[model samples]
Target chain A: MPGTETAYQPTDRTVPTRSRERAAYDRELVHAILDAAYVCHLGFVRDGAPVVLPTLYGRVGERLYVHGSTGSRPLRMAGQADPGLPVCLTVTHVDGLVLARSAFHHSLNYRSVVVHGTAHQVTDADEKRTALDALVDHVVPGRSADSRPANGKELAATAVLRLDLAEVSAKLRTGGPNDEPEDLGLPHWTGVVPVRTAYGAPVPADDMDPSVPLPGYLAAL
Target chain B: MPGTETAYQPTDRTVPTRSRERAAYDRELVHAILDAAYVCHLGFVRDGAPVVLPTLYGRVGERLYVHGSTGSRPLRMAGQADPGLPVCLTVTHVDGLVLARSAFHHSLNYRSVVVHGTAHQVTDADEKRTALDALVDHVVPGRSADSRPANGKELAATAVLRLDLAEVSAKLRTGGPNDEPEDLGLPHWTGVVPVRTAYGAPVPADDMDPSVPLPGYLAAL
Candidate 1:
């Protein structure tokens, strides 16, 4: 899964008319972008209207897995429909604020991945367990090995859905803002204020045993 | 906008099937969650399939505005459709990662807002200008006041769409993970690793005039 090279072919649906130069088809770039983010916006059509909800996701090679309660709308819909649920999943990270001389040119330097495909409910028990493990490890590395695996009851209540990384594109906007030549002379600061996502020290739960200490994996973060 | 109190009536679309206890209909809570995030996932149907896009947005009172080049597919479709574009807009902030004793109970403490409505193309020139100003100011406070406004040509090429906050809900997961009682003694480290978004030092542009310095608004950040 690591160091694999496969560029997805751009389709009519994946192509953007504006700023086409920012789009990328490289597999490594897509995987890196997807791995960096913690959550994704899952979009599906309901009654001919689109509905987008934020949810956690995990990626393993060419497949992405998202899990939710069996009673959840998307999971239920996926199981009920004859065909799989058509969905669009997207992840984005804003790296910096691009401030320009002109307000019109002000923008954000960001990296985003958009995945379009039909998601089918994962049925196999082993695959479901693996997908759930991936989801846990996705939020924090080495997490899956540290925590207890799900039991049969818990596994039954959870529903995992998988989407192949076939129709995917990564778009990125980087560097300083592109201000007009005339506006460059204007008396305004022009630059990027970088944005960073950092993890803070862990806070123990109220009911946790005091004998247990902070783990090395979390302390490193 | 500050200290306003209004509660939205929860409809079936706004209610969550699972974890209903986390849902909130208070307008102030919804506004706070929306204001904290920089980007939103805009979802709409295209050719009977759902499409989700990450875009910049601005909120003014009960209305939200999203803008893009006229050539963009979503913007063009909104302008062409008489009834406007049926869309869903969502914003999410992941505050912390919850590592439970059991892997099944591991989750993220997050605040999210979901909005569903029809987005109409902004037709009035004055509203369009105001909306554009909001977009700039949204990214950086006091930015629109310091920078040059868009000219006629730039204005013509851009389209702004407005969505009223009629159908909205905010969901939040706080505190520690809900691990099962029997798993409390599991050897895994269990706690909340806080996640935070912060700004770094501003990087001046390559060709910027040296005389101009970073503005107070950005410096404070």
Candidate 2:
């Protein structure tokens, strides 16, 4: 029997050892995890301290774009910094809860990606629009075509930062916990506790015009 | 008719201005959101610089606990700090994707908690065990009772920190996007695209003894 072909190459950029089996180097696996997640926890050192902020993000091919108000502290800091701000952007999808025979070993089945880079602020108008469109489409596939584009005032208030997917690592953990042979007979739960996310029936805005129908792209989602 | 009275106060921790009709706030609500999620983005600043890191966390009644190895940079810096580390711990649950008739209004329906406080390290053994149990049970409810308690050696290697619930806020956004009245006739999709989390069938560990039955608590999850 032949073994499966591996898509991810073990390199300096990949975390080949931290979690040997769970870590994946495959590009498709990496992209799937990134694409499925809607928010990214962006970590950066401001002074000598670390701060993490949960924010909206969009991925364009291998590049990731994050937007915020120009007046936001991080945005201002990134724009003014000499070497730009070093940041660790992370996105995670929690698939299930791992129930181990022992509490000490209980874990979660998840997919996560961490990107290390210096993000620079986008200043050009065309680039800004393109990034903004990517952001909107990321949240809603056809949204850029439906809504009015950002006006001058809105554009002036917004700032978009770009970080290429140059140095990144994806870590994953799935399946049951590794229980010791003796501990297995101790009589405890030993399977995945499933976690799920579902959409409830749509609630239209109280002031909705009711003449328009819900879009198919959103309907499919 | 008068509304039902409850013990959990909705005043302080809940947002008064944006009360989510579909959302509920109570101890159960708080615990569920905290337990189902993994990885909290801790935000803090050192020397006027901001930084954030992905770290493991556990939550007890009205308090959230985080731990790191003693050699961890943040732990060392936090131990020496005067007012402890000024930290913001945030956990978010992305419930669904909101598709708006207009691109500008596209948003995500999510439930998130933001906690602001100074984190202090845990030095006492009893408190450490309590916090560790909370962390364990936060991920798996009954397993804490079944597993071997952390021995002295393991406990000695971990550094635990705590943040109270006094300065915490839980914000939630649910349902479809609120499209503008005039934009309704523009023939755009405007409904929620559901996001879901599903679990594959369990794969037992190869080394399991096979004599022990899966516990009811784990099965219930």
Candidate 3:
């Protein structure tokens, strides 16, 4: 298990004003939320305008890595020789929808982590390979070991960028909606509709060999 | 039904260089993706750094509205007297996880829509009310009609911003993973694991009146 003693020191950007009680600085909770979500929205500035792209991400210790084709705009920008790219990467898991008596109180139960920092391109070969493995393992637990590793040409074509988890905060809202005292008597129902991500049976590829059985790790999912 | 005749004109920024075939400019498809996803990552430049926030949003025709507290940074910035905030709003649905024979070929099947434009504060009371209702309905169909509408004080506390759907593009990755020809004989399993956002049974609030019946809209979920 990872150490729980270290907590992220929140910066001005990570601080929450509205519903401040939901904000968490504990590293354990932040790591848990990051680990659970496979995809993250990476925000970056392109020509003074903000651009958000959804992509796969992996976290290792206090560092998070995102890889993409070198030809991609965001990847090329991060790999540039100048100062690193300033990004705010966010991962959110919507747990449920809070149905309140009044429309104003209707909200979502969600856990979200926001990381604000500069991302630098990984130049070291060892770090790049490890990041790639982590990325695969992130989507599927035993995927990296089960599948063939990236070749030299493929590694060269891929760009892996790393961001330190320095300024990060996880905010989550749970339980039922907070309805007004008077609205409780309203005819409408008030409750929490839980939302969950479920995985269906693995569908074999059309060209897959008939003898190949589904892996245990995937079957477990 | 929405007309299928109109299509978004792709600009320099909206054009996709990678997987060009997956890029779509059809307004109908873009709207469908936006409507299906309840939450969107709103991206805006804050103090020269990119900030991406996950928030609830609603769409009406060609405009998308996101509501937040009046004191929130993004809302406040959008309502500023100067030029409106240039924002990128994105909604993504992860349909499935593609497990490929090679780790390098592993990918995801997803549908995502990106809207790039200026977001202006909706000051009109009528529009704000409609947007609020649309937001409630976005999460649960017929919810706005079933629930009590927001009163004056609640409306005062909320701030809604509107973004036009002019600069929009929907990119989707569907079907199975594309593995290398040589990797077809690999022992690893290769397939797509379908993912779905499922809704569990509703949990009534502690203060909910026992006499109140579950709403039909929620029951359908």
Candidate 4:
């Protein structure tokens, strides 16, 4: 199953060699973590300093896409250079809190994916529409078809950037904390404190045209 | 209540003047968003490239604290220079999924704080303990006191970085999507899809010493 491509030495960015086992080099694991996250932190350096922005993102097969206004600085910068903008995109989902017997061993149960790549701005007219659709669909599955497509002016003003799924890694921590054997006898309550995310009932806008019914995809979500 | 000391300026690093109004400068609003968040994205440039990492963080007064092992690159870098490491710290809470009448207007309802500063490593023994306590209390209140304090060896191995909350901004988008007046008459369902976070029942470890009872503070959390 892991014989799809030749393996390369994946650089350890966050966790070093001592914590290497927590890092997963599998593509499926990385993709799953990215797909499940609602938002992503896009990092880019502007004027020799680092800036991180939390934004919505979408994944299409082996490529990830992000969109912003054409006037946006980062979007414009990505299209300027030959290699585009060298960026690191990260998505994380906190699964649970690992409470260990020893304070030093306490940790969190989380699934995260980090992508290191040079993003190129999407310029083609048809491809822009396709990318926008993918972005909309990723946020709300069937709602893209029910809503009006972007007009020519709107499309022209928008900027879409695509980053390939290369140089990526997934790190996951699940189950409870691995407290030391000696600490197991310490009089401290220890376990996994669960964390969860939920969606509330959709509230229709007051100005909504009463004729239109809620879409099935939104209701399902 | 807008005191002179609480005022924040829009620097070149700040999201331009137009985007600045949408960016809140209020301290209370900033603290509310920060305290409610468990994780923050730390962004820094490495070798002319942007790198973003998601990690646990805590806020105490006007200072934000992030900790890591002394061997970590970022931590080591932060400890080197006198002025410290230039970093951008951001914390965001997703409140709702905004569904607009038109697909172009689709966005998220969120509250986020972005702090632009140079992080200084905490070296003093007393300050380190206080910062560590704040970190633990930020996650689980009172748990810091209940657990064993870090020993000299553990303290020496850990690195705590602090960023003052001076050049900070909090941006929030609440309510439903701001669809255009003309689009409001369109036959499309539009509104907000709320998002929520909840805590689940605690799962005690099998090897946990039964003598220690669940602390009231943790139980309340």
* Chain B TM-score, one value per candidate, order as shown: 0.96, 0.82, 0.96, 0.92
Tens-digit lDDT string for candidate 3 (B49-147): 999999999999999999999999999999983679999999999999999999999999999999999999998999999999999999998999999
Rank all candidate structures by their TM-score, best first, as comma-separated numbers.
3, 1, 4, 2
Among the candidates, what TM-score does chain A have in each?
0.96, 0.90, 0.97, 0.90
lDDT of 2 by residue, A1-221 (tens): 11133354455535542346667667677778888765898877644545566778888777789988787667888899877777778887777776666656677777888777789898899988889898987766667877777768778888899987766668888777876555667655466666655555565554455776765655555
Docking class of 3: high
Name model 2 segments beyond 4 Å from true: A1-29, A45-49, A80-83, A146-148, A151-153, A200-214, B1-38, B43-52, B68-86, B165-167, B174-176, B193-214
Complex DockQ, candidate 4:
0.71
Q: Model 4 Cα displacement at A122 (Å)?
A: 0.5
Cα-based lDDT for every prediction: 0.91, 0.70, 0.92, 0.82
For candidate 4, lDDT tens digit of each residue in A124-145? Answer: 8887888888888887888788
Best by lDDT: 3
User: Tens digit of lDDT per residue, candidate 2, span B1-221?
Assistant: 11132223454323332234633555556666777765687766644544455666888766789877676656776788877877878788777777666666677877776666788888888989999887777665666887777767668877888876655556678766776666766555456655655544555565555666666655554
Which 10-residue window of candidate 4 chain A scores lowest in summed lDDT?
A1-10
**Interface root-mean-square deviation (Å) of every model:** 0.9, 4.2, 0.8, 1.7
User: How much is the lDDT of residue B125 in candidate 1?
Assistant: 94
Candidate 3 pairs with clashing backbones? none
TM per prediction: 0.97, 0.78, 0.97, 0.93
Question: What's the residue-level lDDT of B163 in candidate 2?
Answer: 79
In candidate 3 the C-alpha lDDT for residue A131 amounts to 97
lDDT of 1 by residue, A1-221 (tens): 43355788899888888899999989989999999986999999998999999999999889999999999999999998768999999999999999988888899999999999999999999899989999998899888998899899999999999999989999999999898877778889889999988899999987788888888888777
lDDT of 1 at A7: 89
